[model samples]
Target: MVEAKTHLATKPRWLTPVLFSTTIFLSASLLFFVQPLFTKIVLPHVGGAPAVWTTAMLFFQTVLIGGYLYAHLITRYLSVRAQIALHLTLWALALFFLPLAVSAGWSYDAEQSTAGQTLLLFAAGVGLPFAVLSANAPLIQTWYARTGGYSADDPYFLYGASNLGSLIALLGFPLVAEPLFGATQIGWGWTVGFWALGALLLASGLMARGRHVRTVAQTQTQSAPSLKTRLLWALIAFVPSSMMLAVTTKLTTDIGSVPLIWVIPLALFLLTFVMVFTNRPVASMATLRLGYLIGLGVLAVVFSNLLGIHVSVWSAVLTVVAFFLTALYAHALLYSERPSAEHLTTFYVTMSVGGAFGGFFNSIIAPSLFNELHEGAITVAVAAILLLIRAVRPSRTALFGALALVVVILAKTTLISTFGIFVFGAIAIVLFLAVATTIRHTEHALAWVIVGFLVAGQVFVNHGTPLLRDRSFFGTHKIVEQDGLRIYGNGTTTHGAQRIVDLTADRPEPQLYYHRNGPMAQVLTSAKADASGTVGIVGLGIGALACYGQPHQDWHFYEIDALVSDIAHDPSHFTFMSRCAPDAPTHLGDARMVLAEQDGLSFDILVIDAYSSDSVPVHLTTVEAFEIYLEHLNDDGVLVFHISNRYYDISRPLGRLAETLGLEARIQDYTGNTAADPGDVGSRVVVLSRHSEGLGDLNADPRWTPLASDGGRVWTDDFANVLEVLNR
Candidate 1:
């Protein structure tokens, strides 16, 4: 042993850490990069709902648990040589399944659960390679722990390097890889990266071979951890894992469900891991606790809408920052509780189990149990309780004061309306600060107050008692009755509305985006001459567009969510479909997929208005998608795109598509005075045709103008960058 140590000491100092770090880094980079890439590939088929990403996250987390388990079992039971041979064989087997692409046989099935379908698709496409890659972080770290090097006693720092690689990959995907490379190119590059990782793994294994026997004996001498400690590890890991998905879903629900939105929260999550796992953390524990409390307060205010701040961009930034602070603090606590290097693989296994449970809860359990998007609020409450468990007890005065404030705020119903919202907001802020200052030294008191605020906010603020609330794999839908109108809402966007007094009237007027003076009505008017022919509409929001259909027209509706279809057909909730076009057929699946199945069908006019909240589905706007639309249109038929959005300039990309196909395109940006009719809000619509004469007489009207295609990139299914077209 002395001679072996002498021989090992003769080698260079930095080689082992660098070798293991590089191997672990490459593995982590590939692991994270493939998540968004593969999910993006399968997104269009799944209807482009934000829930798709959440479901995909559940699948990946479950697979990560398997990978961590594999690492623990192999490192504990097998000899170093056996472990190396086994892992390498697994890598080699995974290669045959690489250069990842969805199989030709796979397609979305409406009969089955969408989440189940998404899981199966991921399992078939990238499961093997991802599982193999996931093992490298823990597996390589275990090898490093046994290498008998100077730093072998504590190998956790390498985890920082691993997460750094993950952060880089996530950040690089939207900014660099996604813009410059297609899916095929990314797949091939990833395959080459896999080859490189394999070589590095082999080199790393050989270096650790000689010392493993001795280190195994040494590790056996150390005391194993208690069950309580293992459970603690899991609970600490669960909060941030669940919070990451919650924040992602919140952002993507309103913003576009593109790779950029998905990557931001995940990148921040990994960055926290990188920050906390280092020998010297970026923030001290004192600083972390304070920041975390501040973050919770900010999030509570935002979620409750206490101040009525409606700027989407600022709201998004604040939520993201709050998430970052909470995750950073949670991970720092997790790091502080980590076990010794001897039990490192076991530690990681428990953490992965926790992460898997978090994903399972958010993706599967929450959607079934809750009517609203309450996961974010619930996670925050849980995090505060767990994180402040060690805080000192508060004084009786402070506790009583907090309770008194909570009671007063909950009972301030008419007081708020009488004094105005801003005055109420100011008074609430002052009361919270006074109580928080009294219990400055006792974090537990602060936590309880925050929890009370969250409970009160969830119960009294932000949302109303809807006439009906429904949730599914797509999103949350609420039918609300307010201002003497029955409104259908999905996420933050209003889908359709109708006056309650009009329920008994025949052919009730369409409201919201389909109002009489809105762009949708103008498009339908332009195609009035072709009313006797077939008309196909993509989105079936309360079947509002059904009222615009003429009696002799063959009207067909395509809607992805079955819940929306049910709501639209229910006369109790919405009478548009029953009264206007009672016989119109509604297809229950993704618009593009169902349209592709229509072999000999063609429409005289096609309207594409599919949106999840204010977000337009990217798949519907891609070049390949337009080709399908064109194929289904008559020579003189027009394609109408409802491009109204608060965050993105979608019309630019559509214009670029028109220019690429040499098709005539015109746009209408209609802004009606809402004071005249609340439903007559602003809308941006673009119309495309194969010829100039196809636009009809209204094409000569001054309300419509040629589309501006400047600085726009024609998006294809293989490539799109939403970052470029953001509304500055």
Candidate 2:
């Protein structure tokens, strides 16, 4: 009987580790899983603007700061029993808002302040549950450290384990959860996980019932850390948090705004936490030697216009590694400077503040202040400068090791359009290197050359007046006139190109996507069977589709980006809208939102020329969005979609959606003639309608074949897998 009693008494030893670790892990997993899932649900409301995700990130980070503050205060004042009761009551209150879904009524429009509206939407949607989960790791760790246990000497390892769960949940959501389950199911799954976390939290508090025991480390160092130390912790946390958004924004601006793009950078962000916050840091000061040097080159390639359009997978892989390694070194430093266990919650609160500030600056401030995405480049340069300023007295082997890598990297040569900065900027870099080596500051000199080139090359190469330039929350737009053609550019991809020189006696020719004999032109002409009719368009790119507008016809345009609308409507940028549909009514909002509010069967034809460069605005391709178009169309109205994209195989998703919507669809590709003008580039468009007769004359042509949309491949408001349609 005594043996069994002793065995039961000793159970608390093993129970505490599992108790604390499981509570933190479950809390963190649900915390991150809610991010992408809820974002995916509300994405359609904002037209899937990349800015939506960025602004959402800004809100999330800010809330995390608040959550951490709550935790810090609770740790300072609340007794263990009171803390457990308060937290449990908070979780119980949070459950009242559950199943953890975004309300349909919680939405934002273009005219409303996007940041303010989205902040409210996200707060209403997931704020309560998130706050309850956010405080769990730090709070639990604090409680554990106050009690006695073998592992309590460093309850911070529980923090690392928490991030490990976060990493797994982030990567798993897109890779496994999204592809296999619907949005509602995922939300319920998260809710179940949250309940499980709550149960674990209760168990942890029950297990750590003894006040006679405290970790020796906590009891030994009860003095508060210096304010300077606290502030430094925040700044260190800020750089990586801010850069996390910057890197994600950069990738989305280049590629499409998708969940997979979101998770990769976030997954890396969590991984650095897991690696650096462990009982023993994986990002050792020794490993930081090479990591610090490689970061400069990573920044250079990422910001340089050299890899603008042709960012291959190899380059993408390099950016990911650079992002990871740069953050790892910063965290290694953070780990080394960590305050003692007594100041645990205070440490996390300051770190959260830094992260929150970084995200706010990148998502909210940078967009308003800079005319371009200068955050990513600026963040990398700042990291590089910070690194070089903290350079260690390296051994000869470490210096040579860095130099060897530099030589091998510079040896990689390509054409002027492909990595051609070598020829134009190599002189300055080499000169700096020669001076640095001749003097004593070899490492600083090498770092400066790379940093200078990245900043300067962006200015010299990418900052040209391409005529009209504008930056928005969406992305940067550079309108450069070339060969007498006005080109609407979003980063490296051309959104629209139109000839400034008129090709006809009266009207400006639609030379690019809307050429005279193109599929779009053929369909429009057939629909013009009546001299006067109503025509609606989803995207207003330089108003290229407006050239088909006749004097007798009424025209309406719904454009998501007001900047794109302004550029298209301005006569100086493009004469298409002025010459063709001068007085057409323009609606400035997302197609799904704006058109859904319009009266039914008001159009003879609808043209969707709204590809934001190579990316398809995903929300517009789903069954619900298609149904919106049909509602606004006349009985026999034609529904046109310009599906030309370099990085996405949109044919499959659109086809799949069409099949689900019970619409007849056909596709046509305009392979521009070699002898034609450079502005007369090839294009692809898909046309869909309820009946064969609505397709007009395009159906008679052999090029207008069927679009095969799979029922299984259909995209709806609740579920979409962008990975399913990658061109690769």
Instruction: Tell me, by lDDT, which candidate is best.
Output: 1
Which residues of candidate 1, in runs, are more than 4 Å off? Answer: 211-214, 305-311, 391-444, 462-464, 527-532
lDDT per residue (tens digit) for residues 438-536 in model 1 = 655455646665667666655555566789988989998988898878999887788889989889879898887888898789878665444438899
In order, the Cα lDDT scores of the candidates are 0.82, 0.75
Worst 10 residues of 2 by lDDT: 410-419
Give the alpha carbon lDDT tens digit for every residue of 678-702 in model 2.
Answer: 6566778888888787777766779
Off by over 4 Å in 2: 1-9, 215-222, 388-400, 403-421, 424-450, 503-506, 527-532
Candidate 1: count the clashes.
Answer: 0
